[model samples]
Target: MFVQFFYMLRERGVPVTPTSFLRLQKALSLGVIGSIDDFYTAARSILVKSERYFDTYDQVFAHYFRGATILEMEDVELTDIAKALLEEWLKHPQEMAEALGLDEEQLSRYTPEELIRYFLDRLKEQKEAHHGGNRWIGTGGTSPVGHSGDHPGGMRVGGTSRNKSAVKVAMERRYRDYSQEGPLTEIQMSEALKRLRRMIPHGPRDVVNVDKTIYETMRNGGEISIVFDRRLSDRLKVILMIDNGGWSMDPYIGIVQTLFNYARSQFKDLKIYYFHNTLYSSIWLDPQRHLRPEAIEEFTRRDPETRLIIVGDAAMAPYELTGANAAIYVGQKESRTSEERLKFLARTFRHAVWLNPQPESSWGYTWTIGAIWKIFPMFELTLDGLEKAVQHLMKRH
Candidate 1:
């Protein structure tokens, strides 16, 4: 069972290494785990190292174990009626409450949380999927679990969120899509990239005045202590690689430039480089930003404290991510693969990140996104995503 489980994880792109698998087996053989939940705890702790793999790990674990169900649901249509009509009820929530048989007196009797509990009581009684029904937990009905129905508030188990009264939402796959998809304004991207430049708490030390600190401390009570009076270094040493061209990348050029400009404003020592899809042998530093005669090994020799940031969509033909002479570089004479170059960068840099302008929801559709995500901790080019990625980097250094 463990062998099949391990294979299933690998097949699902979880990247479970053989060493991790061996560790898990040794742990289980020693009876370190005690229960079903314990196995989950032990397996995940040993098998998964990064939070980026959590979604994939969860999927593979649920599929192989079949112990619990993934509660997230896709948008389902209520019977044959258009979803627009059901959505209209959002405008008339009070009428929906009346239509659902809730009286004003009853609303006064319970808090909103109790009302949700009452609805869940009704939901628990449901046994199967229902559509166009007057009762039971289903769609196109008065049931609270399904959408396009007349209810004050429902769990929104399935179907599109037709009303604002979805007091409970299982999981939102659309939120990420909307965030990374088109319609993202410049202001939002600016705000997101602005969070990347954080004041690090520690850096190269300035002069330490021991005599002054001791005098100051003695001047006060014994309770007072000497202050470090440390100053923050605004020095920013970062390298950026932006994806240059392609039809798929046209929509994101503006956003990428916004991040580029914002990062430039933050770090005076920001080394800017350009690569169309991925990096190969080396990166270029020229007046025209062309990949003009420079070696990646030179940049690799830079102080390890330097942070490297890659801004790209990370979307390409699946084959582009695989092969020795991969990546569309300037000269196209490099001998190493894109993955190898990235591995070298990760080893060389103190903190490396890939800020993808593409939506996270779309990542599962392409194979290379997974490849890149494995190479670097990827975050969307959105404000919240940039914040998360920056926070991770800040904690690391």
Candidate 2:
């Protein structure tokens, strides 16, 4: 019965597998789904593995269960009556509300099912655009449906938010870009980085050691004897170097900085530094690059096990990375070229991953991006990319 629904979910990129569908079938057969809300909750729990895809799931569910052929406010071609009604409603919204007998208290009383039913009824009855009236899919006033309206319940059809009280947004999907495979947020980045944590025993033995307890108990003629061992603590050391130079990097500065600050607070031995375009002799302590620069050798001298995460667009002039022009080292004598510095950093760290803010698809189009990518395992600065990078680093660990 739900074969079409299952296929629709898959077509919409919800990643619904056959096995999970069978499980859902079994669940339905067992009489678990009692209502539309129950079905939504249960189907999502069974089919959707990640919360990021909840928006897509909601869209699919609404399309399948709720009336799908309803025209949004924008899609409705304005008839003469609709145009006249819109003008009249806009001129006197308060008077129109009194005439329509619609208010916030009445709208607030609607349950989700009632709201959906009301929306479908409104769609069936409303054949044109509504501007400021209540009880129709339109803009302004206290409608349970439509955008820029004040409503405590019902679906938002189209247009920008004004009241922020839509039970379900029937507009364009808001979280389309928030899939697990999409771009990175600070929280997602932090969660991906957390997977890199390696816990080892440290400090005092405050907790009971199970293995030791079992061994000692067996040796002591089965007497119950407790053993305490050192608590396991995070031993992961990370050095985050971000590219914060040039106009090309301005867009990525905020998110990258947020991740850096989060990492500094999260990991015990995390060191963060900033660089411009490409790695040179010195890495900066601040974003403005005004403070005294720290030598790159300081990080290079660290233990080889230290993981390095380099966040940059890597979209710079080839000369900036390749050529040792006078600007990079004019009067001062330097032993290493930019390429050599990159190579040295890559080799020094046992596990290093380069996170390019530019999408991976465009990596091949840029020259400098390709050059840097050769030296490190480069991945896009996205949730999927970060997770893959973490997996790569974990494999080495």
Q: Pick the candidate with the highest TM-score.
A: 2
lDDT, candidate 1, at 169: 20
CA RMSD (A), model 1: 20.7
What are the lDDT scores of the predictions, listed in order? 0.61, 0.67
Kindly list the per-residue Cα lDDT of model 1 for residues 1-397, writing each as its tens digit: 4998788778766678999999998998899987666686688889978554555565556656664444443433222122233236336556635744787576557654354444433443342344233321111234322132322223323335543221122122222222112333445655655545545546545546578767777887645555564556556577877766443453354456556556666677887776657776766564233537467777757978777888888877765667776555444665767787777888898688898877787788778889989989999877777878777666555
What is the total number of backbone clashes in candidate 1?
A: 2
Q: For candidate 1, what is the TM-score?
A: 0.47
Error of 1 at 393 (Å): 1.5
| Model 2 stretches with alpha carbons more than 4 Å out | 1-183, 216-227, 326-335
Per-candidate clashes come to 2, 0
RMSD of each: 20.7, 17.0
Candidate 2 lDDT for residue 122: 52
Candidate 2 residue lDDT tens string, 294-352:
87787766978888899888877787777765234355455567887889888888799
Task: TM-score for candidate 2, please give it.
Answer: 0.61
